[model samples]
Target: MATNLALDPSLIERAVEVSGEPSKKAAVTLALKEFIARREQRRIAELLGQLEWDESFDHKAERSRK
Candidate 1:
């Protein structure tokens, strides 16, 4: 995983400072994880109200079942 790329130095510095990571690699890792989580959350958000709900379903009855 020893790859190099032309990344912005200022952005990297800001990420390190804001994330309080000890090194650029740590900051980048945290940024990538957060980016992935945010994208997944957005995808889930987009699914809101897209599922069908049964009005006759009784949650209390289901919970009381042995």
Candidate 2:
């Protein structure tokens, strides 16, 4: 897909240096991918303390039983 948006020159240069992607396109692509992955991880982290755990469940013990 081809799309155009205004991007910061310095950020592009820094991404090129850090990612060592050899081209602006590659660097931009890698940066966007990493950015999305990091955002998803942060979203998942926000759910860390909201889940209920079962005190009676023993996953390791179940594995050992096998």
* Model 1 weakest 10-residue run by lDDT: 1-10
- The C-alpha stretches of model 1 lying farther than 4 A from their native spots are 60-66
Regions of candidate 2 where Cα sits further than 4 Å from its true position: 62-66
> Across residues 1-66, which tens digit of lDDT does each residue of candidate 2 receive?
999979999999999999989999999999889999999999999999999999999999999894
Please provide TM-scores, in order, for all candidate models, with all chains considered together: 0.85, 0.82
RMSD of 2: 1.6
Per-residue CA lDDT of model 1 for 7-62, tens digit only, reads: 99999999999999999999999999999999999999999999899999999999
Worst 10 residues of 2 by lDDT: 57-66
Number of the top lDDT candidate: 1
Task: Give per-residue lDDT, candidate 1, residue 46.
Answer: 97
Q: List the residue pairs that clash in candidate 2.
A: none
| Cα error of candidate 1 at position 29, Å | 0.2
